[model samples]
Target: MKTSRILAAALLAVGSGLALHAANAQQAGLHRTDLLQQDIGLPGREAIQVRVDFDGGAVSIKHSHPGEEVAYVLEGSLEYQLEGRAPVTLNAGEALFIPAGVAHVARNVGSGKASELATYIVEKGSPLVVPAE
Candidate 1:
């Protein structure tokens, strides 16, 4: 009985620590600002622009979008990895294009805040992004 109680307590402590870590990660995750969005006169398609800021150690999980994405680095640097391709480091003034439906992840690998301007050509009614399974 004593051993079981000790195991329970240990589990509870680890669970609490994991909860705290998740909360902190959420606080330090990506910050995005919508810059522009407009219809391009194509049925169900729109052009959207956004600025994404990543704090140090920030990382985005594998995800995919329904449309083409183009990102331009605005400050600092990041590592972008697309499915089946080697990860590439992108610095300020550099740009990358991701074809629609490709899984990818991005991480801020610099010591300071990193930012990028992202433009998407996507269907108007679809989710802008979705996590990959």
Candidate 2:
């Protein structure tokens, strides 16, 4: 079970009420931009994660998620894995989907640096990684 823990837990307090870690702001960035998250869990966000990577290489295979995932190749290629299935290869403009609670692995697989964008949507408080499998 391999994974990366982003955070423990979060909570937000408003005018007359308190919200249980419901994100904080709207985020946007480019390649050289570090994974900037203004409000990691923007309020009213039903659960959405967007990742854009550029010139990616020398990467490791990591699995972290217990919910559905949709990925789009912005450039180059990507190699990924999911529980009970073989590895998959995706090129630029390509897309893939991952089921909930599935164990998966991913890395850049193209000869040159790879790039991609991924969006994961789920319930609030849901962990991005569930201790792998």
Candidate 3:
């Protein structure tokens, strides 16, 4: 009975670990890694940096930030659609600027995967990303 209980416990631990890994894998299609966040010299403002990776055909939902964003493509190709502006496709080493509060979407247009280094300068204490229509 003791041996059986030990075996069951081991199996349960492995099962939970696999469940956690699966959840993470699902989110790997669109991954964001924050690199830095710091209070800037400007009063009431902060600067943030993040690396975002998108699998082929993956897209970020329409969203807006409280401040300006500088998106620099690190790898692959991505298309950006900003509200009321023409969609722009950027390749590796390309970049774009997004105005504060402008709704936009980013889609991976490459054959495999795409990545971007996003830098933001925004108001402090406010949400970095807000969902937009």
Top candidate when judged by lDDT against the true structure? 3
lDDT of 1 by residue, 6-56 (tens): 999898768755653553355447887778878998889999898889989
Q: How do all models score by TM-score?
A: 0.78, 0.60, 0.79
- TM-score, cand. 2 vs. native: 0.60
Give Cα distance to truth, residue 24, candidate 2, Å.
Answer: 19
Q: Give the C-alpha miss distance for residue 53 in model 3, angstroms.
A: 0.4
> Which residue pairs of candidate 1 clash?
none
Residue-level lDDT of model 2, residues 1-133, one tens digit each, is 1222222222222321221111111111123222422334546334455565534454433455545678788788888777788889899999999877777766677777766666666545544445453
Worst 10 residues of 3 by lDDT: 19-28
Q: Which stretches of candidate 3 lie over 4 Å from their true place?
A: 1-28
Tell me the number of clashing residue pairs for each predicted model: 0, 6, 0
Better of 1 and 2 by TM-score: 1
lDDT of 2 at 3: 27
Worst 10 residues of 1 by lDDT: 19-28
Report lDDT (Cα) of residue 19, candidate 1. 54
Give the higher-TM-score candidate: 1 or 3.
Answer: 3
